[model samples]
Target: MPPRTIKAAIQDALEDLPEKKLDKFRSALLDRREEPRVKMNSVEGKDYITIAQVLVSTFTEPRALRITLELLREIGCSEEAERLGELPHEPKRISVISISQSIFAHGPSAGASAGRYMSGDKHFVDKHRTALIQRVSTVPSLLDELLGRGVIKQEGYNTIMRTNQEKMKELYAGPLNACGPDEKDTFYHILNQLEPYLILELKSTK
Candidate 1:
């Protein structure tokens, strides 16, 4: 027999799950498919450039721009980062969490646009949920370090960490509480927003 496609495998597996779990899985799959697709080539390059322009124009503050650039780089948008870097600095206007959400929602990702369906294995879902929880649990310490290093002032650090906490709450209440296809992209974006700052902190310590 020929190898099964990922969607076929997921459909077969869903038959064995309980009704409630199956409903969640189905809903998640639908949401994932509904998301906008980007081609990631020259045609889509203009769209990404427009997004970069919005980020640069929307976030005028130095610190906000730096964090946004870090997130763009984290999510594999080097061109966007470079574009933001070239813009003239302006005053602060938006919150870190707002910028994070904008990038998570609008920014392009290879995995996001690949049109791949997630596995329906219970163990796989549980494993990813646990990992995301652990990663989110470290935000406090990470924010403290950023504050100590003067990378962000106390007010900014508090604001960003508060945003992180709210996201953690949502994750636990929704995706982590019950794994769904939509959760994978949501969790990955959260990590993308934080990982760069954590990496920078590590480098500063060395």
Candidate 2:
């Protein structure tokens, strides 16, 4: 019998994943393929590496390794991809605290500092309500950047924005009726959910 191709092997491995996760992998893989290739000698290549490293860190080790292999294959690095596939598959245990620590370790310039601020030692929204509102207002721009970079599909982008709009409407019933603490808290919770997407957008932009 002939050995399976790299794609076939990947598909076989993905069969164990839930439909939702499988869909995400498929979409990300397709999007990566559609992106223009960055030459290794170009300045863009360094930026791409930085973005890719940050993006992959968001996933479990197994998923990250699989995606890295897929990306290598997409970029015509079949030999490296094959070698990566042969490595031991050990999933790293990640937590919100650990992720926040990693971001903070990079210092303020990493742009990931915002994430640490939001998740770290204190709740920025609770402590600085006015500033939080200002940051929330920038969600639209972040969504635009995410869509432009193909980090999110049009459908996903529309869904997330629409949901955010609905949340905002509820949080801001009227100019006279200011959002109560509870409402503001709920909005902050939604922002936390969207933080990973925002982080990916930031990494790509840098």
Candidate 3:
């Protein structure tokens, strides 16, 4: 109910996710929080589990999940987030091949929202549509954080953003932009060759 208590509960939930995915989740939440309707607790006075929580619960390292609840307390209080009933199901898991097929077969953005369906974070999707849209606006900042962390590269960012002026761009542009199969192969080939050279240099470090 109190902001301090609500913030603590959220921090705990996030600490449960994979370390790698943490920044993206936080960045999205920070952006999502700008909306007045994005209440931390549900109408029944329970804190909702975020999509990031499901992703962490499903894919993060064992130690990473351990860190989530604790971190949440450090950030906010859990008592404020306690809900009245059972949380929602985790999102479904899809193989890399399935994701590729879906993207290539359909289009980049096609069914991107389905990640919510597959993972356990469906509660947020079902309850907070506007908040999610606000969160989507934070993707570029999340990618920038990932670049700063060295988890992904400039080429990855470029590939990720080329068509990102809209949703689903992350899935489609690489193959769609290809002149043909051979050209696609050659383009990736060139990108692979120069990846290390494109390392993102942080301005603060300089």
What's the CA RMSD for each of the models?
22.2, 14.9, 16.2
Show model 2 residue runs off by greater than 4 Å. Answer: 1-47, 50-177, 196-206
lDDT (Cα, tens digit) per residue for candidate 3, span 1-206 = 33233233344554454554454434333443221322333212222345434324433432223233323333453432222001222112234334434444564344355322211332322233332322232245434433443334466435434332343244234322333332222222222222211111111112
- Local accuracy by lDDT, each model: 0.39, 0.40, 0.33
Question: Relative to the unseen true structure, what is the Cα RMSD of model 1?
Answer: 22.2
Once all C-alphas are superposed, what RMSD does model 2 give against the true structure? 14.9
By TM-score: ranked, best first: 1, 2, 3
lDDT by residue for model 1 over 1-206, one digit each (tens)? 56543223222333344555434433332232211322233223233233333333433233224444444444444554555444433222333344335434554343345422233544222434443443343456444433443333454222432455564454455434553334334344334444533323322331
Model 1 misplaced stretches (Cα beyond 4 Å): 1-126, 137-170, 175-180, 196-206
Clashing pairs in 2: none
What is the Å distance of residue 44 in model 1 from its true position?
A: 53
Ranking by lDDT: 2, 1, 3
Total backbone clashes of candidate 3, pairs 3 or more residues apart or in separate chains: 18
Model 2 clash count equals 0
On lDDT, the stronger of 1 and 2 is 2
